[model samples]
Target chain A: MLKKLLEFLILWIIWTLLTWSLALPDILAGVVVSAIAVLLFSDLFPAEIGRLLHPRRLFWGLVYLPVFFWQVVKSNFDVAYRVFHPTMPIRPGIVKVRTSLRSEIARTFLANSITLTPGTLTVDCVDDHLYIHWINIISEDPEEETRLIVEKFEKYLRKIFD
Target chain B: MSNLVIIFLSIGLFFNFAGCLGLIRFPDIYNRLQASTKCVTLGTIFILLAVVIHFGWNSISLKAILCVVFILLTSPTAAHAIARGSHRAGFPLWEGSIMDRYREDQEGETESAN
Candidate 1:
């Protein structure tokens, strides 16, 4: 019941912001639409909301953003350099790296981070391991690969989502 | 302020162009996705950041920020879905590829499932 209410509230808030208006008709329509959405798709919502608003998680999330952006900028340059080089140097491959995150949300977040960072793109996630397609196969060791790709993001995500 | 916006816009356009170049030059689907996802996503975010800066404190800037958040959330997931689907559909990696751990893992799974 609380989950449904939360979902409805969130949807209504988003609708209100998107519309950027506070007329009575808009508010009433938002309420009606959000309620219907919650009723129809409550099952798709996450089961746990207990830690979603925790203070520590919020703090870590704030810290994670700058770190994520810095990495994105650096990697964008790296990729751009590769794109323009006289000889396109790349040794692409699918290698597996294991994640310590237990929550599905955290794992998905990690995969997305990997996809955006450096030369790695997540091909699949099987159980605890993520198969990443790396453009430059630098290290053959699985542990090293995991550290290079997953370490920086996973630690913060572990605090935020796990 | 306008100068800053132009700088961001140019950076975004350059990356977007690079991403397209990669898409055309890359050997296979997975590699193309890697290039397009990373470069294009950052490119779009930078472009949206310019929009926010240009609009200042207004509803348009707020919407631009919201678009950035949405792109950050959805772009990689879309790429991941395509890569996973292509691999499952037996899309081959480049001939010069180094390894195939996903296929190996799949074989291992079937052996255990049996």
Candidate 2:
């Protein structure tokens, strides 16, 4: 299947990058390893390879990295400020927020993004609601919290996964 | 190039130090985990990025990128697991905490079922 080949190609690229060698044996080994990995883990991949291969989805995925990295930097600075402050202003609490993303991949991606960004950690997800431990409980309203926490990432993620 | 590397290195160190400060100063395990997870991850990634910049496109840089990828994937998951585990274990939140919607939701579900 094209999906399997795509998986193999991705794995092979990573393999080559890691090895960084053009020797015949290295290339042959990468091919073998990548093939085996694809065979074993194909089912773990997103079911709709067609959707994944869509140019729009690929473009959004590429765009997501810089946006995510920028947020990470911002969050680090925010947390650093909180950590170094004399009073250590924090109002931590668990707030539940709803997510519109239907796919498992999208939901997981959102959760990971929330956790990676400073000031929030996803405690749990049940049904469409995610329980997040926020460093500063800005608002208890689920809709408001969702807007504050999930909106920025979800737009790009929806494009990529949903 | 050397100056760029020093800048990255210092920024990384600063963030790492902030994370350590957070661990000490934050009230509870959950908050501490948040600090450790986010700050340390960014710090490590920056340090790795610095390595990549210094090494150009060789195997070392590639390995650094791989490490960044692995950290990005694993650290948050690990933090989530720990936070969830601690919550389930009834690790108390800070005294200044305001809400616990998770417990309220669970209680509501049980009440409706009963």
Candidate 3:
């Protein structure tokens, strides 16, 4: 099946990257390992592989990297400033925010992204609601918080995963 | 190229130092975890990125990129697990804290149960 081949290709690419050699023995070993992995994990891949392979989705995924990187840098500076400030200003709290992302992968990705970026850490996700611990609780409204925390990442992630 | 690598290294070091400072100064375990997780993740990724930039496109660079990817995926998950564990263990927040939605949610559930 197509999913099996996709899995095999992904695994083989990782193996090649790990070994970093194209010699005959290495290639043969990689092929064998990748094929076995595909067989073992065939059920894990989503039934609809077409979405994953879509050109627009792939492009948006690539676009997301730099945006994420920039946010990381900005957040590093923000945390650094807060740490050094004499007042040690922070309004830490857990706020409930709802996410529209339906897929588990997308929700997980959003949570991870929130944790990695400025002033927010995902405490839990129950149903569609995410309890996020905010170092600086700017807005109490869940809708506003969702906009501040999840919207930026969700647009691209929805394309990639949903 | 070397200058860029030095810049990256310096930025990484600064972030790492900030993370340590945060760990010492933050009021509670959860806040400390937040500071340490984000700073360390960004710091480590920048350091690995510097390695890639310095080495160019080769085996070592590829491996460095792989490490970056793995760290990106694992660090936040680890932080989330620690935060959740400590919260479940009833870790106290700082005195100046603004909200406790998790506790409220639990209370709500119990009230409904009754």
**Model 1 per-residue lDDT tens digits across residues B1-114:** 699999999999999999999898888998899879989999998899999999899988888888898899899999999999998889999999999888887823753465
Candidate 1 regions with alpha-carbon error over 4 angstroms:
B107-114
Q: For model 1 chain A, where is the 10-residue window of minimal lDDT?
A: A44-53
* TM per prediction: 0.93, 0.86, 0.86
TM-score of chain B of 3: 0.90
**Interface DockQ per candidate:** 0.68, 0.61, 0.60
Error of 1 at B58 (Å): 0.9
* Residue-by-residue lDDT tens digits, candidate 3, A38-126: 88878866666666778887898899999988888888888898999999989999888888998877888889999999998888777
lDDT of each residue in B24-96, candidate 3, tens digit only? 9999988898899889888888899899999998899999999898999999999888888788878878889
Error of 2 at B40 (Å): 0.9
**Alpha carbon deviation, residue B20, candidate 3 (Å):** 1.8
User: Which candidate gets the maximum TM-score versus the true structure?
Assistant: 1
- Mind giving the per-residue lDDT tens digits that candidate 1 earns over A91-133? 9999989899999888888999999998999888877888999
Model 2, A108-144: lDDT tens digits are 8899999988689998877788889999987878889
Give the higher-TM-score candidate: 1 or 2. Answer: 1
| TM-score of predicted chain B versus true chain B for each candidate | 0.93, 0.90, 0.90
Cα deviation at A137, candidate 1, in Å, is 0.7
